[model samples]
Target: MRKKYLFIGLFIFAILFTFGCTSGNNPKDSFQKYVDAWEKQDYKTMYTFLSPSSKKSISEKDFIAKYTNIYNGIEVNKISVAPDYPKSFKKDSDGNTSIPFKVTMSTVAGNIKFNDTAYFSNNTKDSSNPWSLNWNIKMIYPDLNTDDKIRIDKTFGKRGEIKDANGSYLAQNSYIESVGIVPEKLGADAENSKKQIADILKIDKGVIDKALSASYVLPDMFIQIDNLSMDDTDRLSSLAKIPGVMLKKTPARVYPLKEKAALLTGYVQPISADELKKLSSQGYSKDDSIGKSGLEKIYEKQLKATDGAEIYITDKEGKKLKTIVKKTEQNGKDINLTIDSNIQSALYDQYKVDSGTAVAMNPKTGAVLALVSAPGYDPNDFVLGMSKDKWNSLQNDPNKPLLNRFQATFAPGSSFKPITAAIGLKTGKLDPNADKNISGLKWQKDSSWGNYYVTRDAAYNSPANLLNALVYSDNIYFAKTALDIGKDNFINETKKFGIGKTLPFEYGLDASKISPDNSIKDDIGLADSGYGQGQVLMNPVQLVSIYTSFVNNGNIIAPYLNAAKGTPGKILESNVFSQDISNTILNDLTQVVSNPAGTGYGAYMPNLPLAGKTGTAEIKKSQTDTTGTENGWFIATNTNNPKLLVLEMYENVKNKGGSHYVVPNVKSIFEQFCK
Candidate 1:
């Protein structure tokens, strides 16, 4: 009995051994081992193949160290040896026989399943001589049941809509369904799929061919182009009939007003390298979107939308079967602005013909009504991608089409007279009645000076009183006031007026408006500033705020910004100041604008009941010209309404028949708006 049992065990062992000897070696693993041995110059293995280098200088140690490290789906799985391929004798470019070998690549890099077949026939003519991969890797990314799998997902959050102040949709958010595919699932037809898709999308077929032919491993499917005429929401329904394509729902950024508020609203682009690095450092990927310019950039965190990722469950055939993991996308915070889209649109339409800015704000609340910088672009231009031609035109334009001048420089011109008037009254140096004594003041320095004219027969000129000073925008009249107030006091007063500072707003800003220097005590400098020239400058909004202070009774209120944090909304900060000199500046300014000979007579707005001043400063024409145009300006405030301030500036040079050119432009806008 013992002998019989032992014979049975031995027979079983022999059967097991015979089976192990025939198929025990993992074909894929054994093939790799043979390749590794051949690489190391093992004579036995090398005998079976041609030596790449006759010298065989690399030792096994060196060979092991030199092996390239690649992380891929194949590397992740324990692959089995494949069946031997049909004998092939392929000719090289030099007419050498091509060796044929077969390999059973795993379904994917990590998954152990396999489908399809790989036939390796040596290709001696391809330029790159790249290793070709064959066989099918079932995509398990989407669920096994095609209908149950998700093709694409929102990046992180639900998309937010863009709306105007009146709750009108200007730029809105919507979802687009797109079809995606796994290259391996198509087997030998991946190339055909690429060509077909490219042709349907009306793109360069070569691009598709290159992408498809170069793909050795299955790559993430990105739907580059889609049916433009078809409804985005119904994309899946139409595309399901397309070959090797799956459907996914995704949200895209959109622009509503298009070119209307393009410049102001700005545009969005794919995250840049630097921007991507910023996000990666914050634990985000390169797919995130960031603001490129304008309001979007200024308020990136608020306007930016959030995206969510989809966790796909794929079948063994490499087809997405289901989503076992998913987090609901969270949309980004919505931003409500102070800009009134309708008014801004109207102003932009008018400004399209000119290069200027239009700003409207409440004198009391400091809330900006419409802030416009001309030459607006279509914000949509930046949504998908910006063309180099469009970008170059804007960059190279002589008019500085992309620059925002509303809060930048408006060339104080005569509009600056209001501030000088305030400086005079604020410092207590102007005795509104001081000009009553029309005594000629001497130029303390006899040195050579700029184009300065102190009336040699000053006594002959009309009284240079504060009223007459603002009335005529007399350079000499205010020059006397500056000298009386002194430069130190002037600088201090100017800073208090909020110059050389940025207002808190949603749009990107230009921080160069007001500059005051005590060193500008020269009769020329002081005189220039007296009538709004030399070193003094202000923007339309700044001028409005300055005049508003006078109307607000000594309160120097900070400019209003549309971007701030509030309850269910953002609230901008408003700083107010009430100094003792309030009454002085207001009373004197009223007298100046009311004066019959006042240079600002044209500024009189009966319905608005405004007080104002006008100015014409001689500056250089352009950067290179020695003579610039006569810059015209008008600034006003209505104590009766007490909520609106208006400032007008015109760069009318003596060249284009002077004031006939630009002043009328400013007048027309003011008339339409104020009325």
Candidate 2:
């Protein structure tokens, strides 16, 4: 019995000894530990599993650096190292095992995938690690070797062009004649020549001083001062005569319409530092240009294409080795606008001295035909590096050339009377033919009103009804109509016309409002708002949309900017006015332009029958304030065709014939286009 127990214990000890030997000598186990460390990027732990000869060939620090440099240089991500080993241990003649593996990583250029084998041997001197990997530079990449190079080749995409309705290039990539300065060529007259250059360029002296102060500026290097328009042959000639002022042709973003379309097309400048950091991963660099405002800004992503690159490995002899990743460049898309260049140029021509905004639309389809803001700066000035003085001049101009006025709102004045009349007729609060029997240039509703009174021209105080009131722009007549509609009903119905709501346009517009907070506080406030005064303000685009309802059988059409999105009969407000009610207001608006006594009669043409209204919005602290200014407005379209509808407003038209100042402008546009 003693011999049997001792034999059983010896058998159990033999089984345990065999298990320890297999676990310590397993190549699969050692390879797993090395790969696990590799996955975690723990190079120190990976170094511990390297063979004695491999460790002597490269230091741990150098091994870690080589991996980090390659990974960072290619902007690598999703690094995967998958090992495929044989089910049974197979040793070669040298007593080493080979483990095949696959590596895949996503990089900026594209994806990189390769397969390689890792050789592990049990010839290590360390007792703790019997199995060790034989490391070399090829382990980093299959095609990699000492003195090989990894390089990135960048391919830039072309920026998109912006075109108008007639296929005219509003904004394009074209070259312009540029004037520059060679500091060393100035000779003894450097200061005089700089002054002459500034004078010819219309730039400030400080701009020249700043350019000269650049650290990289050399006496012989040509520093660009400004670009000249093709029409500026005289200025180019003037610049050529100046010493040290060299003329060169360079690539630029050219705006053919110049100041006529500056506010609409906008411009681009160099990518800012903040922009670069935010967009670095998307392939944006400091050399790129970004849109600053207008439609260029609204469609920046569509206009700016992604830059492509190819990352490759090369030997010391500059020979092609292997392409790690390759990406194809994509050019930007061309944006086609619905704007008519003829109408845009004509409208801008009328505003040489005044500050105003004009919006022309196709009343039937809601296509925006033209958007013009007067006193506009040349958009090309921005692309060619505008001088400090030139920039400051635009900023300091009182006319506020930088302000996008079409997106802004202003008092609609008496031009709002037609809208009020329509609303009144819809609510059954107004009778078109019935006389109000009020006789006065100014009147108020009872003694409850402190000192406010709704006034009209002294010549329009008889038989106050809707038709006669609109013809003469009788403010008191419409004021009474609004009070009858009541505050809550008026505000609610007005909001139905898209008032107090953001316009559904790609280009952002300030929402039109009934009042400051979309409410009328008192009868006086309500009365003033009735005539498009008080807190009432309307964007020119919104007003054109509202006016479109009159010509569209009582449905306000949705305004659109993109030419491809032209959907005729796309209604923004459905049935805001009944057909009969809309007809009545339309007939009255016609008489407002046709009748001799009408305020808008100045807009009447010989053969073209037009219908419209005129508004002179008073900007003052109180009704009695004589120091107030007026904004002149005229909204007109041909009743015969109902195709082209235009609304124009000029600021501070106090003495310039009031609303009549804008009458001829619209009339001329209709005479030219409506024919």
TM-score of each: 0.62, 0.79
Q: Write the per-residue lDDT of candidate 1 for residues 1-675, one digit (tens) a residue.
A: 999999999999998887654322213333344545433435345223322332154443433332222112112122333344334324346433322333232211112332333223233343232222221112222123423322334345543445555776555665444445555555576666666656565566675555555546355565344423224334345446556665666566666666666766666667777766456433234566676776677767766654555445454465765554444545666666656776666666754455656666667777666776666666665664455767898789887767766747655665676666667766667777665454554332345654345431123366666666665555556666777777777766776666666654445455434344324645566665665666666666766656667666656455555434422212222223344456655665665555555555544455545566655556764324665566555555566665545554444444543322433444455566655
Q: Candidate 2 — what's its lDDT?
A: 0.87
Compose the digit string of candidate 2's lDDT tens values, residues 377-462: 88988887776777899999998999988989999899899889988998989998989987867899988786767888755545
CA lDDT, every model vs. true structure: 0.53, 0.87
Highest TM-score: which candidate? 2
lDDT of the structure predicted as candidate 1: 0.53
Superposed on all Cα atoms, model 2 deviates from the true structure by an RMSD in Å of 6.9
